[model samples]
Target: MIIKRKVNKEVYMYSIGIDIGTTNCKLCVFELLSLKLIDSYSFATPKINSKYGYDFDIEALYSQLEQGLIQTINSLSYAEKVKNIVIASVGESGVLINQEGEVVGPCITWYDTRTQKNLADINQKFSDEELYSITGIPIHSNYSLTKILWIRENCNINLQQVKWLCIAEYIAYKLTNQKRAECSLASRTLAYDLKNHCWSEKIQSAFAINHLFADFTQSGKNIEVLTSTISTKLNCNQPIFVAIGGHDHMCGSIAAELKPGEILNSTGTTEGLLLLLEKVNFNKSFLTSQLSFGKYVKDDLYTLYASLPSAGYSIEWFKRTFSVTDENFDLLIESLLNKLDDINYIKNSLNIFIPHLRGSGPPKRNIDSKGLWYGLGENSTLADILLSIFQGLCFELKNTLITIEQLTVTHHPIIKVIGAAAKNPLWLQLKADILGREILSCNIKEAVCKGGVMLAGYENHYLDKNAHIQFDNPIARYIPNPKMTEYYHQIFADYYQPFFEFKTSLEFKLKKDN
Candidate 1:
């Protein structure tokens, strides 16, 4: 049992949160007393060797963080008020660090598709069921172990001289000079034993990756104090605690006020639907469908994550390709929403789209599946086409949600949405109507970053032991329109399902013929 401490209102404290994403990195400063965001900074993630594969310059990311950290710290009136710093990052991407604590190579991006060849070799070594049982992750190329093996096979790096560190761990190492792998990020490696909460000896021996991983540490565990060098660089007097925050989605879910029966829909460049479970439910059918189960930040909970790799990216693609004027994205979104008011017009029109521009994510891991726009007539307008994308994406999420409900024997009629897409009222309404559920907008612009702050506060004992740091009351709630919900039910049953089944059949036939 844990003892609760009484609050001290006289003391003032602050914490810093850094979230490293696929396309951007965000730094947030939170005032611990009020739990409010004081200031923030962000920069686009720099891509390296774009012509070959998607990779990030780890050094560039560190430089941005260093500058951002100093700037944010200077903005605060009292430097001593800053208490701790926590780092959160996207999974599956990590850097190889040498004995001298130097990055040996670029951090491979999870979006990179260069490890397909390594997948077959890995599959031959361990069956999918065995891999999923051990790691609680699907046997996919978009995992750190596969990418690391690919680099070893292709690059001139000496494995004996370096150890693998996830992006969050790399950042923590830079701040405190401690080589530690946070449990949440470590689970993404597809080399961790979820049951034992350590690196899987079977996977390590099979891949010869023994002694190439950092010490596995629990999330929210304070590993090191900020070094004097970092404190001097930031012009700070306080000794900051450096703690580990988990994967961005896990953090986002925490920020979105995750509950036992609720799901968090985090929509940014990509869209992820996360559900929290108190215990691990290792279902064979679920694992076979490629759904991932990993450790959540809370010790008692695990996360089931399903994603659409190109949800928002595909929307941006459509806007870039079709917009005639230099209209702002928000303006385009509002215009599209206004046009969606005419329900009968949309129903009469036959324009339809499939939201798989970057391959289908889970339940159907088909790399060859391409996005399709069908039944577009001469009467179809740009708004109609845009609405189709929204419909298709919602349908895709509904399918994923259904699978999750079946596998877990739980029902989440409402999903809390966060990030950029949560700011769009129309998108929220559409999700509610199509999914036939309520859409609660949490309105957290940088939930991933906020989650990092919350974790830091929890670790430092600034937050209440029983109270969750996430927003409890949603800023807005969207209820489904009965008519729209009914229509979408029919459309999903008659149109989306048939088309998806046909696409799967065609893809399989082509592969067999080849």
Candidate 2:
């Protein structure tokens, strides 16, 4: 993406990017012209264990955000000026606040299954077909609407009296006193009317959630300028403009310049494959595929998105749980690829690993499913298991991409990968071999934050859109190894495919009997 360069704009005019992730929250300051990183700070997201699952400590979250902002701004030279600040975050979690902007209830996370009962109640009222048709989200508790309903009922809060703001929106409100929902994030809520591009009247009225959210706006829409209190709090002399940055993946897609027949594989704690399209597809084929459809960062465009909730989290969980060291698991399996021609050896050595650690996504979206590994021998080493985890995540991604191809009826040759996936060469190669698609490692460090910066730059006439979309070069490329790709095709069809079906059934029976 092109950097902002105009004068009236000095060398020190900068933009701030606030990315509130599930695991790590970051604040980055970038030079609007060079797009050089000036300063950055990071902290863990504050989450507390609730009776049902986990709830975000809002006060703690804001405190950490405030600290990062102050540290980034104060470190600048006196000549520097701040232009715009934008926020991006997870789409599924938010906080409820009273009229005075004080948090009123617990902010439960999207993965918390405590809202299953609330979802079932809604399912009883509307058919799954109708629900998905209206919201473009499958019937799942991971969306904001289910969690909002859970808080409203469990906390005994009056839905009509208070309002909801997603985590990013909350941060913006604290700075600028504007309570606006980004269109992309608002599209994730099950209560949003996708066709009409507004809040759903039928669903909101049925659930008594009228007047629960403020007005929705496009990403990078200039809502308001920073308040005096915030300016003084951060010790900043110049004014700061706050704009909505929308969902993390949609924001990252801006840097990728994602176009038709191209897919963006955003890997972080979670992983999602996002395909940009001129129109939305909610047909029955997509309904069964269970891929989510939502408003893109550009208000007129749309996205077909599929997620693996435990992509990177699975690696972290295995390393932490098993106390595995930072050994090179990738090298341990390189010798195995050489034996692809030996059918007998390949069959005996290959093990099945399924990463459903944070529920299952697409085709059969279920929150009850857990991860599994099969064919583990008594002598299985930690390194061997780690290799399996990496291979498992690649296979899981392939499974979703197959459904995406069948539904969209489009085949993409080169898939652009950003975020954590770009940093890991082994993961990218494995994904290329498994999917038989070339993987381009678009390694712009903190690309999502860069997206926020770019949006703010363009909104303020500091950037050129045509020039910014020219970041079409990949830092690295991973082409599929033909021998390895051929071997994977057989295993994916003969073993992985059949095992996935069996495990889905097993999970269903386990949930039903319980």
Candidate 3:
């Protein structure tokens, strides 16, 4: 039998936020009166097992979401209080060919690397700066534009009868029957103009993409109300307001209270290091503002990001390859910690690692870049090698931070960190030491979901000092040691020089061969 909690009569209204991530989908309900977290639920993303390639099942995904939302509301004391539902989704991965108003194909994921050749061809035809100027996103195979191009070129599917949609937009359409793409997701498509805040006609002309793309809308704008069918499915008769929620990274940054001179570091399947700035234009020599989204306030403030493709993935790969004996994650973490403790000679070791196993991401999208382990000899053990890899990832993050600092002229001494990797004490300490910045670890690690909830709260008039959910003091702060910071700076300089050289050489050779 299912039990339902009793709710206080005073707090009768609530806000809901749904986050659709690469690995999971989560729902969070917050009291509209107090803006406090009331209930939450999560489900693994439904994937179709295939011999040829992996693909997400849209029907299964919607089913999971439907069930998860029902379960989430049922668990709450004031289930009927929920009046607003906002969704934040992983952008670039979601692609569908919509004919009139129906989905035609499985939503292709951003992780799928099947369009490498298409990406190469597109890049060759259009310069990187031109693409960035048009779409505010670097040319990459992970983008929906290239994936759509791939489908058009390879498949017998008719491209004339479809409207492309991002995952969030599709979910919104499913919820409200109104098709629109949020600015945050649209910016990642390599088809939206950052300055004009609309679909780029020049880009569409150059790529020969369909003009039936979904309309772009700003986040937090109420588009529609829930239908009787959706209300019945959730066992609620209350009106449900549908508001646009943008990219996951942008939402996560919002949760962290990201402002000028503040950085939000998200470490999940991949690490996304983002900065929220008031200005859009920056010097072209170093970092670029690849994407921007409307801020919650009236005046313009955009979330600019630089992402690393392999952060937590590096740790996952290491765990799978090295810690076969420990099936439980707690035990694996303990084993890793114990191994690190046992390494007495690591204090004086000069090992270095470069984690480019699946290739590096932004400022340079080097597909051929391979992971490297330098200064490895007979004395190196699995534990030592693991430490090197961990440090290597930190070094890459540090390099990115340095570049951002140089280009943007904004230095954030403290970084707000969220996601699964934030739980790793070793990694956090390493990041602090390498970047020479204080790392503020969030108590509630699910910043993306919380950000969405915050948006819902704002829409429902429930955000203030009295709100239970506040992004103030960090749960823990990792401060860098002066001596260690100095040591790392010297090592970082040496490591970065060879790294860029290697990337340049690889790109040159690939171009020559092609």
Candidate 4:
């Protein structure tokens, strides 16, 4: 698919990026000249139910994408200029199986936890350390591999003739009729060996699951061209270009221009912090994989990531649990700030919250871990609870930072904050204090989408010789408060020690019970 690059004064070439998220799907079009987002649209993901315990609705997915693209195009000032489309989707290991290669089971959501038993058994068979060393991710029921194992054990479906594809690959198949998975998404699967950049024969043999993996593509490589049908649907005379951008996290980091000592924190439904590194730092204790997706950057770069299963979800939970209306919730949070203007409520508050309402993520991927409220008494009020939740999230971020720091002897790298949560001044300030470092918040809220746009722009020759995206928004930096930092260090140490000890004991108990 070739597009004629016509240089115009007022008319700039645009690239489109579609992010298929867990709850919603987003579409954004960017002007290649300035790398500025020109237009954007989003739609809620359609839910599905299946006969085999799992539920996924591909028809709804198709409908949403169609509607989102149409709406986005209609809203654009120059829709005809959109020359490329890139997709970054959530990762999963389950295969869509049928005689005709149709998606049979629902897209196994990364949040789904029905495979607890499968995960425990996998851990017992292959020690947690070894599994992490191979997969780069800890053994968790949420992963697609365990979900597949669960379905095979319980369902009556044949594993033969099935094709395993990640969420991104599945979408690409639907759009372009191709069955290709990218290295970024493939690496997330427990079966993929990070070091070799392919499915691990050793891990596959250990699991004894049928081989149904898809071919892998490196990030930033163009995989397939859009079908004529999709081009007609979008009302574009030009061909739709599809490229292999990796996991949303990796792509977002690339969009943010992540470098060594520079971290990218994406705050959405799940908040994650990724640190770019030059070389792999293997940890035998944790058994982490040394594999990473190749960077789009000219120089070699790797990433160390820490994800929290619940970040914005925790706030959502709080709102629903307390029955706080959206308007009232904002007002209440604003009121808390006004009431505690003189106090460092997040750092100095006596209360501590463990935000594991769903489950703990990373370092301790404990599914059984429940949310807890510590140091709470009669004096604890709604304001205190609110502040505690923020502190809890900050503490989690601090824990991940400390782990990355220990793994790599780096210190005080400027952390780049992005996503919806980055808009929260109090939250960003709390994170700065907890980490004892400066936080740089990018002007762009949709960094992942912009990252895709950056890739598409580079592919289309929209970027300058230096490969930089020209934007008007200046980077905002927040410095840590030394007083609050000192207090947070003490609170973090006391609160985290007990949590780790409790987590260790709980893990032992779960193993013994199993």
Candidate 5:
């Protein structure tokens, strides 16, 4: 929904970056030489609520993507200079298509808990330890394996006859008629083997689902070109390499030049804490904590990732509940935060919110958990309620950050934040105080999409090795106030912990009863 035109007649080579996110699907054009964004377009991701859960409308999703792609290319001054198109998307959700180019099943959202029974059935056959060791993912309904199994059972489709492609790969297939899986996203599916970097024999032998998996490759590979018809439609004469961009968070990590000791706080619809590693290793703490280990977008590397199921998504829900549009979301939130400031909100909070509107993540990954709030006074104003919800989100993130530190065995000096949350000064300062850490928020917009652009340029050898360093991010640091940090620490330990534990117990009981 945003467009910016840059005219540079000297530029003859460009790269296209497509980011298929949970909330929005965006396309950006970057100069291959400088990686400067020239043009962009965005549209809402096509997902609708279903009886089973939220399912993506594959045709609608692809239609919007194609439209955005064509429009961006057509808007660029150097349309024929397009050299590479790279796709990055959220992990787990995917489409199943037949040999005749017909969609065979729904692309179920990863967070849908309808697959809980499917995962439980899987656990009876494979131990959690064995699954984690082979797949580097915990036995959770949020992973793709459970969703695929649920689809197989409900849709009653022949798994061998159709091909499975994660969201990004599906886009690649539609554009180039190529079916492949990137390493990082493939690892999100429990069917992938972490050690072998291919589809797992464990899943094949156990479930008899073999041909469903596509050919595997790393994120940086470009083995196909845009279809001739597509080329003509976009009025481009030059060949455009179609590169596979991996999971969105990992792509952001590449743009941020994230190192081993540092952490990337990627906050979008969902928020994740990612750490890079040179060696393939997992801790026993990961097994208990449910922290995910996966193949990095860059080959020969690994990632330790933990997530909060809802972050900005919660804010979006709040905005919708109040009928606030994007144009006014920030202004409204700032006004509310200021009102809170006048009342000494930090030292005296009457509400403790458990932000599980979607689900809970880490230490206890439960999709069945529901959102809950307590201590709302009869005199509570709208600002009080809003601030409570926001604080709950920060509290949940702080809990996961603490758990991630324990599993990784390092207390990072500063957290590098990417995505939309980094741009909101109110949220940044609040998070810094709650987490008791300095926040390094990247001001480079569309960082995830830029990562895709970087990969496309790097794959085509259009940029030098030091291009990541050249990103030259305008970082805004949020330092925690000493008194506020101390107060938050006490509240989290004394009040938030007990409230969260109680909600977990209550939600579990309600689920069991139903």
Candidate 6:
């Protein structure tokens, strides 16, 4: 993991990282020498509705990407000085493109529930353990395999005319006409063979999509030289290399300089805990707990992930429901903090929010699960509700961390907190108190995009692969309050654990009957 500085003739090099996120698309320009941000632009991703479920218009995404990238590049003093363009995108949302490189279908978003009906069939075809062994993914409809199956069953797609491409590959194809699937993103398809680093014949055959997938490419590998057409369209004259940057969380981990036994808690629209492993642990805890495995940016590495679909989403819901607008949101949370002088009183009166507004993730993987507020009363104030949401999210993350530790038999002493939620001091403190671990807040907000820039520099041979991967010193670190930590331990064991057990049991029974 040591990153040696490459003494290349190139003194100054710049790279553009286009982060194609679920909520918005961002293009970040970075100076490779200092890993400093040079420029950035963002645009909303268009969401569309299909007969079955929600989807992203691939053409629309590409259009916004082109606009944003061109604008960002134009702002640079030496526009043509940029050398690389790497893309990091949300996983599992893929589209079929025609031979002409035209999207034949919409990008079926991972959040869409249209594939729910196909889950039973998926489970019947492959046991949970069997699937996990092959692909490192538990049986779930959120993956591309189930979505592909759903499309085949519902849409009369002309299979022979199209090739499958995830959002990263699609963006790369648009730029350089190379259709190689980045390994990290490809692993999310549930048809990827993690051990072999290739598509799983068994999984593909099950869904009848044997020839649809693109050939695999190592993340950060230069797939193609930017096409002259794109260079002209972007008004850039430099020789630009187009590279695959992998899944967003994996990329974020790269920027975070995550190490073995360290967890990256990426908080965004959804929240996920990512851990890197040199070897796969197919223990019962992992298989039954619904932890997912995927390829890391490094070819020899793998990643384990568990997420709550509505962690941050639930907070947004509370804001809208309570009419907390963006301008006053921070003020309100600050006001709430001022009221909590007595930890004992706050903990005693606070409600427990089960943040599954969309659905639950891991262990249960229940789409039927709904958001719930427990221990609420007429005396409960806005402050209690706000704090409860943060508590609930941390509780979910703690449970996931516990499961990971049990499966791997390893303990992570500190959690690297990144993304939007990391900026909230109250939330960071709550996580440390609830999880009883040191919380290191990352100063860089665009960690995922920075990962793309890092990958590009590595690929272009300007970065030393032997030097230790170094991150900027953490902006701040929150230590757990001993009393609060001890109190939460008791609450977790006595209250949360029992409730989780009962809820999961009920969910399992319902799943069995259905």
lDDT of each: 0.82, 0.82, 0.71, 0.70, 0.82, 0.82
Clashing residue pairs in all predictions, respectively, total 0, 0, 2, 1, 0, 9
The regions of model 2 sitting more than 4 angstroms off are: 1-9, 78-80, 325-349, 468-474
TM-score of 4: 0.89
Q: Give one digit per residue, the lDDT tens place, for model 5 in 426-463.
A: 78887888898999988666888888877766666777
The candidate with the higher TM-score, 3 or 4, is 4
Candidate 3 per-residue C-alpha lDDT over 1-514 given as tens digits, one digit per residue, 9 for 90 to 100: 1322333544477777788877788888766555556777888877775542456776788788888877887777666667778888887866565566666755677766677778777876788777765565667777778778877776555666777878877777788888887777877777877777778888777776656588866576667887778878888877788877788877776676666777889877778878765656623453243333322221256656777777777877887887745356555455555544333454555677777777776555565667777778888766666778778888878777776777666788898888876678777877887788999887564677777767655654556624445543358898987777777788878765586667658766887898
Supply the TM-score for candidate 1. Answer: 0.94
Model 4 Cα RMSD, 1 decimal: 3.9
Backbone clash tally (model 6): 9
Per-model TM-score versus the true fold: 0.94, 0.94, 0.88, 0.89, 0.94, 0.94
After TM-score superposition, the amount by which residue 281's alpha carbon in candidate 4 deviates from its true location, in angstroms, is: 3.2
Question: Cα RMSD to native, each candidate?
Answer: 4.0, 3.4, 3.8, 3.9, 3.4, 4.1
Cα error, residue 151 of model 4, in Å, equals 2.8
Q: Model 1: residues >4 Å from true position, as ranges? A: 1-10, 323-327, 339-341, 468-474
lDDT computed for candidate 1: 0.82
Error of 4 at 109 (Å): 1.2
Candidate 4, residues 1-514, lDDT tens digits: the string is 1233343524677777878776678888877767777778887766554544344455677678877887777676667767777788766634565658676655666776677878767876788777766666666677778877776677655666677777667777767877777766766677777666678888777766546777766565567777888878777776666765667877777677776677688877888877766655446644442222222222446556667878988998888888889888777678665543344454445677778877776666666677777777777777778888988898887877776666666776588888766677778777787788899887574777888667655655656537665444677787887887887788778776587568658766986898
Q: What's the lDDT for residue 76 in model 5? A: 76
Worst 10 residues of 2 by lDDT: 1-10
